[model samples]
Target: MSDQPAAAEPGRLTTREAAGRLGVKPETVYAYVSRGQLSSRRAPGGRGSTFDAAEVEALAARGARREPPLSGSDLAFRTGVTLIDPDAGHYYFRGVDATELAGRYGYEEVAEWLWTGTLRPGVRFTAPPEALEAGRRAAGALPVHSTAMDRLRAAAVAASAADPLRFDLSPDAVLRTARALIPALVGSLPAEGARDADADRLAQRLWRRLTAHEPDEGSLAVLEAALVLLIDHDLAASTLATRVAASARAHPYAVVSAGLGALEGPLHGAASGLAHRMLAEVLERGGAAPVVADHLRSGRRVPGLGHRLYRGEDPRAGALFALLDRVPAAGPALAAARDVVATTARHTDLYANVDLALAVLSVASGMRAEAGEALFAVARTAGWIAHALEEYAERPLRLRPRGQYTGPQPAQPLP
Candidate 1:
């Protein structure tokens, strides 16, 4: 909070020198100070701020870990949860490779791994019959024109209100609640008479609810892989919201509700549907070139083409796309996706991301238009739980960040 500049000393670097060390401009240097990541001091005689040389170097080292650096105005803060290495175009869940886990295990198995650091292969999520019935009633209470996510959100509130033990914040209790919540949310949607037809596996259960289509092996694989791949990433906006709620010791149900609320935003989980529409444009035009040119001319980004953390490639996209090959139904959409990615790569470094892959698979499988976003929300529920668990172990409310208070100055003392 010190505005006066630090006195020059052997161990201190001026603002300009610190900026050079971080490979950013002075404004960016100030941004770092504002985040409290780097300590700044008043310059002797009010010249300007200077920073501790060691602190600046340490931040530089952390920046190197992210390679090209995280975009979207987020600070390069550290977390013990997920490591998204853009340099290698890969991410890890608590030090283990995510793509490998997604390929080898179902979402249930991988989600358990993220939550407890051990994969529980045969473990499955199931809700009590009464709880599921309650969830369905809550979802049914929503107004017409409700999206699937809306139903999920409503179901969460109902589940929380009905549980007498919802206040428990212990790790074991949280995991127990999560175990019940995932299945409850899945079961709450409108179903085709046989609600439990594919009840043994989460993906097939969701497939029936999403499109009421009987399970196809290839399509099931695509949905399962999409779920596992989206289990966790770095602190996305939704995940951050979940953690902030957890920091206040909100119940597991409330924590997930916080995350799903953020996920509903068009810029986040809903983004996959937009990505699908963009590629549909390429199909209509018979080429990626014109679509790309038109999007650029309009000053809007070509959706789902790139990501901030993984500038080279999104590993989840690669993992999910691999499964699409066996899904012969997705053939045309896959072909169009390839054309768009290839064309975008040729023109700019922007590459296809997981959202683009999800959209393509959704289109190919003949699912509802909002199917991809639903899958994203379901998968990310695991991540929100993991983040909430981590936050629970920290001091309560530690996530409360200070504001710079640039609004109106102190109110006049008149009256």
Candidate 2:
């Protein structure tokens, strides 16, 4: 046999050539690209695209070697998560168009897509009877006149306490419980006796029932959009907390409670509320430009300006701001907030994360600043459920952390 290496294929192979090599049709190649299953680079002259032979071979090898089959963990490992991509220098959501989704889809649709593998065309949550009782119990446990979010958390805690079966961490049970509970979680918002629970009507009723004032069509639409956009983003700190609970084989509600505990911290769920309050403070003091400049000069970190991910812009912020634009900016507060954002953008690489934008949107929508954190918790519960589902499906063993011993060796027994 000749000792020479195989001859290099001429130029770049089209999709047809690449697919032919892979023993699949060209359409399959397009699908691969669409799902982010394959990578291709733009050509020098830009006629189409080129795929490296070595890269394709590596991908094929990886595909062949996949054991878990890249189901639940796909979003966690791939593009646009907490760590910004070194190549793209931005985050993405499951390779879906985050910008478009943020702009186009309501928050509910976005959330549904996050939880299930795909966005169902006309899916709805229908609650079971147990859910209504759970909802009533949850409502009573919350502090009177608390934020809507607080009531929801308290309800979740109460409902968990009420259910003996809740502690069971079986995957199917967890999902069933979540499906039964989420609508009630939302529905129980209007103070126990004031509202009645019927699972099918809970989401719709709660939307109208929770708001302190009547929601105009635009405001309601914006609120729905916010819910969708805030629904999930890979493994946030709270999501991680839920996963940890799941790893411990905690039930779904317990897992969510774990997530809520994490969210209570200032660095996580409370950040947006802080941002909202800070913006209000700035607006109250004078105007956005001066307050922002003073903040920068004083070395005070502006709330809602920086994020761990998204160097240029937070996709959620862009989506929210665009939605907010539909409403009139009638007062100094609106202009000031905008000015602060504009000025802050000039100095820092970080733009507003979801919290900052949510703060502004919440205020614009007439939600009390105190209640904003609770709303955020509600929005994020969807993600917690998604993570819990993944963890339950994987059936991970109990979480037991190993620690390096730093203390002195054991002494003799005490007298």
What TM-score should be assigned to candidate 1?
0.78
lDDT of 1 by residue, 255-280 (tens): 99999999999888998888788777
Model 2 residue 401 lDDT score: 57
Q: Write the per-residue lDDT of candidate 2 for residues 1-415, one digit (tens) a residue.
A: 1111233245445555566666654444443443345555544453334556765666667762243644544334322222335235444555565656655665555555554333544455655656667776767666667666566777787677767788665433554577666766776666322444343232344455444555566656656666666666667788878878876778888888888888888888788777778778776776667767777789888877766765666777777677777766423445656777777777766566777776776666565664457666767777677666556544356345567998777894775
* TM-score to native of every candidate shown: 0.78, 0.71
Quality of model 2 by C-alpha lDDT? 0.62
How far in Å is the alpha carbon of 299 misplaced in model 2?
Answer: 5.6
